[model samples]
Target: MDTPSYRERLNRVLRYIENHLDDSPDLEALSAVACFSPYHFHRIFSAMVGESVAAYVRRLRLERAAMQLSLSDVTITQVALAAGYDSLDAFSRAFRAQFKVLPSAYRRNDGPLEQARRYSIGQPLFYHLAPDVPPIDVQIRSFAPMWVATLRYTGPYDDCYPAWETLMAAMQTQGLLTVDTFACAVSHDNPDITPVDKCRMEVCLSLPPGMTANTLAVRNLLQDKRIYLRVIGSNSDYAVIEVNGPYSLLHPAYRSLYWQWLPQSGREPDDDPGFEVYYNSPQSTEPQDLRTGIFIPLLMG
Candidate 1:
C-alpha cells in the first residue's frame, strides 16, 4: 500500500483499538477495519507502529489499568478484570512485570503525576513536575494550515536529536531553511503507553507558503533522504501552553495539561495530535532557558 493510504488505515485501526479496549479485537477484525489482508496486516502494523497488535493492545490495557488505579477507587481485582486479566494473580504478575510495582503499592503511593514519574524512572529525558510547580497558563490560539517536510525517528525521546540534525542539514542543503522557518515535533505515541524504544516521533520543518511536496526540489529532497511531506490542518482553536525549561519537562507538562488542567477547562481535545514547537535551540540555550510551545487542538462546535 502507498504510504498515506496505509497510514490512514492503520490510524483508523488505532482509534478503533483505543475506543474498544475492553473488547478483544482479533487480527481478522482489525484487518477488516484497516482493509488489509489478515496475512499482511500484522506485518504492516508491526512495521509501521513498531509493535505487534497484541503487544500494543496489552500495553494499552495495562496503561489504562494503571490510570484507573491512580485516578479511581476501584479494587485491584476489578481493575484487573477490567483489563481483561482472568484473575488477580495473572494481573498482578503482568502488571509487576511491566511496571515493576505491585498494584496495591502503586495505588497506595502515587497519584496521576506520581504514576507518571514512576513509569518514567529509567528514561532520563522525561521528568515529573513537582507537586508545588506553579499552575500552567493556557492560551487558546488559532493556527493556519501548513505543509511540512518531516523525518521520523523511532527510539527514546532524547535520542531524536539525530533526526533533527539530519532533517535540518537536508533542509539547509536544499536551501529550504530560512530565518523564519517554523519547526515542530509530532509525537505519534504516548510514551507512557508505548515502550520508549518503540516511540515514534517526527521532526518537521514547515514549507514556505508557495512550496509543496510535489515541487521538483522538495520531491527530490524527500525521495533522496527518505523523508515525508505532510499537511497539518488549521486549528481555529487550540489550547496552548508555553513551557520554559529543559525538554525533560515536556512530558510532565503534557500530563499536567491532560490530567490537571483539561479536566477543569470545560473543553475537549480534538482528534489532531498534539505537538511541540521549539523557540530556541537546545544546543545553545541553557536547560532552564529553553522555551517550547505545546499545542493541543481543541474541538469546536
Candidate 2:
C-alpha cells in the first residue's frame, strides 16, 4: 500500500467509513471520496490497497475490539456488539476469522500481539510499522533522466538561504506544488547525502501541462540511489519505527537490516524496487541527487 498517494485516498475513505460506521458506509458514499464510480471503487481500492475495503474496516474494528476487550471489564457480549457485530455469535465468528481464536479465549489468555499476529495479512517476512527511524548512511548508485521540479541556487552548502529564496519565489510565481502528483528535489552536489561544499537543489515542480513553457525550471530528472538510515512508521501520532543500517561504519544498524526495518515498519517488503523519493532533495554530492529513499529487498533472515 506504499504506492505514493495510495494511502491518501484509502485513508479518506477509511475515515469516512469509520465515522459513519453505524450508518453503514455503503459504496455510494465511499465512492465519492476519490470521485470514482461505485462499480469500480471496491475493486480498485482492494487491488491498490492490498486489502478489501470491507476487510480493512472489519479488521480494524476487530483489532479495536481486541484492545477494548483487554482494557474494559465489560462482558464479551457487550464488547461484541460494541465492535458492530450483530450478535455475540457473529462477533465471535468474525473474531475468530481475524484472530484465529475466540474473544473469550483471547481475553482469558494474556498475549497482546500473539493473536493479532495470526491474522497479520499482507505482512512481509520482516516488515513492521516504524515511524521514526534514526538516520544512518549506506552506499547508493546514481542515475540520470530522472524528472523533477526545482528551485535553482548558487551558494555555500552550509548556508542554503539562497536556495530557499529561489524556492519561495518559485512557489509564489507558480502556484504551490499541490498540482504535482509527487514532489521531488534535484540537488546539484547535495550536501546532506554527500560531503560537497557548494550545492544546488532543484525542487520537484508540479503543475499543469504547458506551464513549463515560461518557467525557469528544469524538466529532466537525475537518477541516483541513496543508502540512508530509513525509518518507516505509520501516519499516526504514536507510530512505531524501524531504523535500518548497512554497517558502513562497521556497526550495522542491527544484526539484520531486514530484521530491523521489516518488522519495525509492520509492513512486508514488496517485490518492486523501492527508492527514497525526496520532495526536497537533500544536498547530495551529485548534482542530480535528490532525496533517495531507502529501498530494500525484504529477504528472510
Candidate 3:
C-alpha cells in the first residue's frame, strides 16, 4: 500500500487500541484490523510504532488511569480496574514505573505525572514516555466574529481529516476556496473526557461575504468578548501551538497544552470549544511542511 494508505491503516489500529483500552482485542484481532498476517503485523507494528503492541496497550492503559486519577475523584482501585488491572498492587507497580508516583499520590497532586507523547501518521511514531518539554509563548487577543462554511465530524479526532478533505472538495466545487480563503478546525469536546467515537470537530473555511453553499453548513464563531491565547498563528483566545507536519502529530501538541502549559499559564478554560486554523494547504505543501495554528479557548478576567 501507499504511504498515506498505510498510515491510515496504522492509525485505525491505534484508534482501536485507545478506544478499547479497558479490554483491547487480542493480537490476532489486531492483526486482522491491520489487514496483515500475525507475524507480519507484529514486525510492522513494532517498526512503525517503536514498541510492541502489548507494550503500547499497557502504556495507554496506564496513561488513561493516570488521567482519571488526577482529574476525577475515582478511587485508586476503581481506576485500576477500569484500566484493565485486576489488582491494585499490579496497577500501582506499573503506574509507578511509568509515572514515578503512586496512583493515590498522583490523585492528591498531579505535579509528578509524566506527560505522555501522542502518536501520529508518520513513520516511527514512537512513544516518548519522557519527551522534552518545550517552551510555549502565548499571546492573548480578542477575535471578531467570523462567518464560516464548516463540515462537522463526530468521532475520533484522528479520523477528522476525511471530513476536511470532503469539505475542501465541496468548497472547490462551489468555487469558495479563493486566494483570501481562511481555514480552521473547531473541536467541541475534550478527547480526555469524551469518548473517542463521540468527539466533535468542525473543519471550517472563512466564507466570502454573502456566499452560501448547500454542501457546507455555516457557523458564526463569535468570541468578541473573551480573550484567547492565540498560538499556531491564529487570532483568538486559548492555548495555541504552531505545529508543522502531518495533522497526526498535532495530538501531542494538544496534550502538552492541556497537561503542561495550562497549569503554568494561570488561565482557565472558557465555555467555547477549541479550534485550529490552517496556514498552508495540504495539497500544495509537503506533509512535513504543513503549518497549522491550533487555538484553544480560555476564560479571561
Best by lDDT: 1
TM-score of each: 0.69, 0.38, 0.50
Better of 1 and 2 by TM-score: 1
Candidate 3 segments exceeding 4 Å error: 1-134, 192-195, 210-236
Predicted structure with the largest TM-score when compared to the true one: 1
lDDT of 3 by residue, 1-301 (tens): 3354455566567657765767765889888887888878888888776679988778767766766665445789998898888899999999898877788766665532232312322321223411432344455655656767655456898777787777666666656667888888777555554457756566677776665433332221111111111222224465667876777667767665665566557887664556788898877899888888777777864
| lDDT by residue (tens digit), candidate 2, 1-301 | 4442444465457546645655554778788885678998888788865578777567656765775665445799988887788899999999887678888888776333333344334562122322133333333233223333443333453465555445445554445444343443333332222223423333343444444433443221111111011122222222112223221211122212333333455544433223233344333234333333433433232
Model 1 score (lDDT): 0.79
Model 3 scores a TM of: 0.50
- Tens digits of per-residue lDDT, candidate 1, 5-44, equal 7876776687688768789879999999999999999999
Candidate-wise lDDT, in order: 0.79, 0.46, 0.64
Candidate 3 has its poorest 10 consecutive residues by lDDT at: 220-229
Could you tell which candidate, 2 or 3, scores higher by TM-score?
Answer: 3
| Candidate 2: Cα lDDT at 46 | 83
